[model samples]
Target: MNPLHRNKFVAAIVAVISLTACSTPDAAGEPASTTRRVTNAEHELVFHVLEGKSPALVLDAGGGLSSSYWKDLAPRLAKATGSKVITYDRAGEGESDEVSGPWRVENAVSDLEAGLRELGVTDDVVLVSHSIAGEVATTFVNEHPGRVSGAVLVDANVPDFFTDEMLTAFAPVVEKQKADLLAQPSTKKNRQLLAVMADYAPVHRVFHRRAWPKDVPVTAIVASQTPFTDSPEAAGLWRAAQERFAQARPNRKHVLAENTSHEGIVTERPDVVTGAVEDILKIVR
Candidate 1:
């Protein structure tokens, strides 16, 4: 072959090799660099930050659950609001550390504050909480009113929703579970840590009496199927709590979805929850 042709062939081969070296692995391998780990107060948290042009939204999961609960709903809200969205598991749940325990409402709030700081979420953010997380969101708004711009509570557990008799009936069951969890050797670490931060009774009582912050735009979405209570009185109590929540806030609103369970409001019925969240965003915007 001519010397010029041979030289051109060698150069082409070298270019191909360079391109291959720069190529990144696909979905099967390590995740994209955009998804990274951040450390909160007492836990190493893994999170996904989806960037956008508008305000930010932070998602908080329910009791004993992780941020995966907001898997379906958060992205939808991000799209509707045209803003970035942050979702992460609390300590002891999902991929986060199990080092911290007791998981009290206040601890949950602290974890959230630490997470937002780590993620550099300094701008005004909308907090979207699900199930038992409603208590955390409300408490945080009440305590740190300046941080949050709006809140969306989906099938939140409120105190007034439980009658005195209902609380009495569940007290023994909760204690039994707490005991059994502590007795198990495998779960001892989580239980001990959880016992320190967890206070279900106080959480219940607080929710019953906790008032919605007048400054924040709050929206509550009630699920059609009531999972915790079987009695007619309990059902009525749940309805009353939702009514009170809607009435308490100046910009509060409530919506009920048909055939959706407590968990389904954020998971199965993303459209329903997203619709309500979009409404709240409209008011805030």
Candidate 2:
């Protein structure tokens, strides 16, 4: 090799080592990261990760939504709480690969769990489950209680909260609604409304047999306005259901968000959601 070429090669190797050395690791002792990816059976999920302090936060977007849904909010939560925050797209949503069939509830939960595992997050996290994403968030916590310290349910879909009669009536309507949503160009293709309709009964049956663990802190932020409300009675039922979620465990609180509806709460009501997250932060620490 020529002498000049050898010097250039040595310089490039030195620069690479220097860059690697300069990178820092966050509290959980994992290397500092702002973005990552995790693959499951369905797709490889792209995740936005900001390593803050400790006890990270995971942003779970509602069904028919993706990590982009939390784009504006995840950063705020990380800043406010000074804790790591994670947001990602499920299969058939955002940048993740699409699935062949409908979104399976259990599989969705597994995808979330798999991502966190791949990230090597040793510390516990608070789940911010919005809209339809609530199912996977709650199910993840319920299945892996110790891994999750708390959860902030933002108008989440807690299957056990819906009555059998309610599910029976809303089933077909929701199915058609999702099929229409999937056909639209602007939607997230989460197919969440359909996933809920499919798993509501069995998920409820499993959770009903076992009581919610009282040790985990849960703050249920119930929305005042919801699309589901066609009448005063419908709105009232929605509030009642959220309240029930708050009381599911002893270490839980219910707060009614006055200004925003279900979807808007995630973006429009930052104070409401982050405040709840801060409360959970305090409770956990």
Task: Please count the clashing residue pairs in each candidate, in the order shown.
Answer: 10, 0
Cα lDDT tens digits for candidate 1, 95-146:
7777644556677678777777766786588888876677778788877878
Q: What is the lDDT of every predicted structure here?
A: 0.64, 0.67
**In model 2, which residue pairs have backbone atoms overlapping below 3 Å?**
none
- Clash pairs of candidate 1? 101-193, 101-194, 102-193, 102-194, 102-197, 102-198, 104-197, 159-207, 159-208, 160-208
* Segments in model 1 whose C-alpha atoms lie over 4 Å from true places: 1-33, 162-169, 182-198
Off by over 4 Å in 2: 1-33, 172-211
Give per-model CA RMSD: 18.6, 16.2
Global lDDT for candidate 2? 0.67
TM-score per candidate, chains pooled: 0.78, 0.78
Q: Who wins the lDDT comparison?
A: 2
